[model samples]
Target: MTMRAALCIWILAAVICVGRGHAIVKHQAEQDTVVDSRANTASLVNAANKEFVFRLYRKLAAHADSQGKNIFYSPFSVSTALAALSVGARGETHQQLFSGLGYNNTLLTQENVNQAFQMLLDRANETTRGFINSGTAVFVDNKFKPQPEFLETLRQSYLADGFNVDFTKTTDSENTINEYVKEKTNGKIDKLVSNLDPSTVMYLISYIYFKGQWASPFDPVLTKEDMFNVDENTKIPVQMMNMEEELHSYYDQGINTTVLQLPFNNSYSMLLLLPDDMAVLENDISRGHVTKWLKWMRPRRYDVYVPKFSIKTSYSLNDVLTGMGMTDMFGDRADLSGIAEGQKLAVSEVVHQATLDVDEAGATAAAATGVGIMLMSYRHIPVLKFNRPFMVIITERNTENILFMGKILNPKME
Candidate 1:
């Protein structure tokens, strides 16, 4: 493996890893904050940014269906990493990256994007919420010196650091990168790179780790084996956790879907969407749909039951990204001169991995694992049971920034 060839892998993998997320941003500016106003450029920019995230999510979700597997990815991480990469990107490269990142505020320039993402990194770093540790790092061949502009932009925009490494020693290099990911994710992502080619010159990586508890705790004793209806004809036994909490929820009778908010330790919450039929799960996952769910919701109490499940998924986004109009960035036509001052570079691969563990404090696992929370019955209080497929989201209450999300066709499948 040539050091040159290895650098290609490093840049793509690291940047791609960054396009992922687990670190949740704190509460947004303010509730009274207009969704979009020219004077409120930050607010306007943020809302506009989510449009792209939701669009990307839909595409990735479809990919999950193609593989017949449960999946999750951190779009925030990916965006942050890409923002760092865009430091030296010019022309079409910058255009594609910005478009993919949902940066459409006409009033905001590319510099504004750097500032916004930097602000988010700072917010997560300072937040007291459940562990949200995020950072970016760039490792380069000692023989090559990165330009001041690239390094400074990366440091400011993504809170990134730089290091010199021996890419020729693929074993040590691979182990080092994997170790870094392991530590950053609290060991959730242990082996991101199994083998490193010797031709690498520089590699950059972005990572985030999150662990939060529910505001309401579930009763371990109440957890029991229940039938999870994957479909009309498929049923599997799963460890179903329960709690009786006086939580605010919205039950849409028209769609036979329920929206319940499960608060986390800090300012984060899990907005669960339980539908009556599995067929409707994909149709209702858009940002607009979630916004509507929140608007239509009023406080209600129910005997809530949810499955205790853990899912880990990985994806190769090279094709999807190319399909998303990032062709030049990955091909010879690429112009990544800003990074090295005068050198030409192109990305070769983009791999992303993620894990989701929904085990709260008190709820017991089917194989003896524990989870978390609420209310019930007179003549008969409403019972909200997730004894089937459901969708869940972990987000910051303040910003409504979604950190993680997934659809459970069958908890047992994971």
Candidate 2:
């Protein structure tokens, strides 16, 4: 029998699809000047920086899955890791070139950290609003949130850690990509990603665009008369989309778990894993079993059955990330001196916004639009089983970039 698979690649992989493989090109003079100046300061600079950024993301994302928490992927981790790598650069070092981006160790404190976060948020909010040319209903914030003392410790340790640091900002390039991502994500996320507050050393920018359809599109008519499993002995009334047929790739058996892969247009796919043992294995399945299962696969079309559903989730990753393994970036031991002349700096927040839609046909509904319209939808057999905890992974076919990583500990809450 075919097993379920859900692999979480880094967010940048989606860049491959930004403009039909055009790479969202930038003018040479513009990028070259920024590179020439900050080259020595940032160790993980250049196109190759994406590799290191994703490698770090894979490890951290796996850890989050293992912990059984609802974790959202972002470029925040990549930017932080890059900043860490730039911790101790010299004038000749590329690290030295980015001297303008770091925090003043002297000014590193809780109040200052808050100011930096708010600054970035304000800029992103303004830039995104401008791109939409209208106000959006999207809510946004940062991922790193730690106590003031915890943040201070992260800063002290970072300075004491002695890592090479390089800091610089190229608004033109960052904003350009930010605009594309905002357009693709439908203004769910903002552009203008910057924080030159002296404490910040390096920056990594990531873009994610997801347009998926529910496996089962709620029949405005047949969506009635369905009972959803709420708990061990509880059930609730919900309009569930239901359809059954021979499915191409699907899980046949797994205690109470249900696993299904819903295909989108361009070889892109969504892997949904429902655990039979909800005792807390969703995270493990997300990190461990998914990759292993992908290795053994067969391709064929079959009849499918799924539920139609729609959900839009917004999350703040500050606590979830620190709880995993990024505490150093926000404490006295933060060590981002390489980005600038300042000593005090720590990560303050990470923000993520996501939307999912599923219906009968496939993912075609989401991507249904003319080119450059920043629109996409899906058409797939709806797989409705709200009986247990579950996870979802959205991936691009060519580069295998994971646009979004999520888990629903309590579907009832959603």
Candidate 3:
């Protein structure tokens, strides 16, 4: 069963905020060094988040709306938003969130989860090589006040900001929240909310933005028009970027997949998987496969052809979250009383948006000498062309956290 190649790319930056009882936060800090049990717990949480990432990916991929379309999102952004909501959730609502997030099996307590998130947030905000800004905030209705303890948890554990907006002023409220998101994401997402529901007491939102250049930049002179096979019966024109370099790659004979690692100037890397059967690979892929594939990859010189493209995606994940056993939080039975007393509150919506761009440039200009050397040795190398649909995953090398994950079914589709 030979399936077409699929491209999966991961990018960075995330923001989470809420209104009414929901909040969003944006965090940025200098890199710090630390060795403690909290750090260890953070590592464990990161691993569990990986599981959440794949489970969520499969769920989204199976959605009727996602069929034969491009899928891109920041799992970290969604998870962080829900985790922030969990701070004020009580009883069954909290339990469901913990289970849905794949945290019930672990030995982590609520406080532990908070601390672990804080540690991870600090690390994610560190911008040593590339730009990564992650944060959460809560936008509360002016008429309703949230409990002090709940806000404190969000501020301390999630590094979130708190705001009170008058929901009655729908347009003003929407602009306030959307402008904040636009600024944090570097204008990647201009509008995050629209047609505000007057009954909405709180809005929980999460966002991320990432920009990185290839370690071995492609030469634009070598890029040319190429036909990209979207599927068996469809093809589209794309500007395919070309490069020849010694890149780390592996072929899993058992699964009939070829994995390639493309590093950024930062500590992050994009892992591209080309499988013989897209369905089979998607069904069988797990964190274990990712770890094994990375471990087994060895460097080899190849002439690679990749499409230069940009994509943006937006999703309303209420149904998806409900299907994942997080139903109570969106219903009247939701125990969000912890967020505010004497007022009924429930999450009305959960929104997520992300964008990514790839081109022939790095943080610094591509080395002219390096390009010349690669051109000199290009003839004997094997060719690896990404002319078909494939999967892409962006991950932090040190923490092994999957910042973003998606498949490119059609590059021309925005």
TM-scores for all candidates: the values are 0.85, 0.49, 0.88
lDDT for 243 in candidate 2 is 41
Ranking by TM-score: 3, 1, 2
lDDT of each: 0.66, 0.38, 0.73
- Index of the highest-TM-score prediction: 3
Residues 1-414, candidate 1: write the lDDT tens digits. Answer: 212232343221111112223343445774554333323655555676556566666777766443556656676766666767777677788778777676763666767777667666666666754356676888888777778888888876677767778888888878888787777666666788765767667787767666665667677678888988887798888888887777878877767888898876577777888877644656555666667766676777678888887766677777777767767788666767787755666676766666676664621121232343223456555788987678776667767676666677767664
Locate the minimum summed-lDDT window of 10 residues in model 1: 11-20
Give a tens-digit lDDT track for model 2, residues 48-72: 2234234434454455333534433
Per-candidate Cα RMSD to the true structure, in Å, reads 5.5, 14.8, 8.3
Relative to the true structure, candidate 2 reaches a TM of 0.49
Off by over 4 Å in 2: 1-184, 189-205, 212-225, 250-257, 286-288, 295-305, 360-388, 396-401, 409-414
- Runs off by more than 4 Å, candidate 3: 1-35, 127-130, 362-373
Model 1, C-alpha of 216: deviation from truth (Å)? 0.4
lDDT of 3 by residue, 5-28 (tens): 111111223321111212224334
